[model samples]
Target: MTASLSWQKSTYSQEQGDCVELAVIGGAVLLRESDNPAVVLRTSRANLADFLQVIRQGPAKNSPPGR
Candidate 1:
């Protein structure tokens, strides 16, 4: 939202409006839904990394419909 960080859409973003955006600001991770970018969620980089590792090892985040 501010000029401090740049937000990028999730690589796994889908066409049906299921989009995730992320930014790194002030040594923390910021996340928002592309459909509604106003609401921001903050988390630690370490926590985000751990969750990503689990998701990467377990299941895909945005699997397309009927795949």
Candidate 2:
């Protein structure tokens, strides 16, 4: 969204509508919808790393989707 940061699409992003853009600014990571770039969200490195870890592991067999 800013003039300095370079945004790139997610590696896991396919040709489908599910896609996110990433940009690194200073010590923070910025994320936003590829379809709607105006709505941007920023997160700390630690939080982002944790989120990615969870996504990679995925949900347990007996657990719900959000678990």
Candidate 3:
């Protein structure tokens, strides 16, 4: 169950205010916003890795300029 998983918030998050948290459960990764813990998003490790990689890469090619 999610209650047993150890959720961690990013250090980049502000000291106060809601932030996203991540947890690893078996072969899946769990994510939830601090303000709305009940609404959790679950995905595989590979998918999460790919998503993060895209975010780090910045805007995609063929997209509008300066957006």
Top of the candidates by lDDT: 3
TM-score of 1: 0.67
lDDT per residue for candidate 1 within 1-67, as digits (tens), equals 5446698888777767668889988889899887787889999999998988987796556977654
lDDT of 3 by residue, 1-67 (tens): 7788899998788989789999988899999999899899999999999999999999988899987
User: For residue 15, what is the lDDT in candidate 3?
Assistant: 81
User: Which stretch of 10 consecutive residues in model 3 shows the poorest summed lDDT?
Assistant: 10-19
lDDT of 2 by residue, 1-67 (tens): 4656798888889978669989999899999887888889999999999999988997878996765
After TM-score superposition, the amount by which residue 8's alpha carbon in candidate 2 deviates from its true location, in angstroms, is 1.2
Q: What ordering of candidates by lDDT runs from best to worst?
A: 3, 2, 1
- The C-alpha lDDT values of all candidates are 0.82, 0.86, 0.92
Candidate order by TM-score, highest to lowest?
3, 2, 1
Query: What is the TM-score of each predicted model, taking all chains together?
Result: 0.67, 0.75, 0.85
Backbone clashes in model 3, listed as residue pairs? none
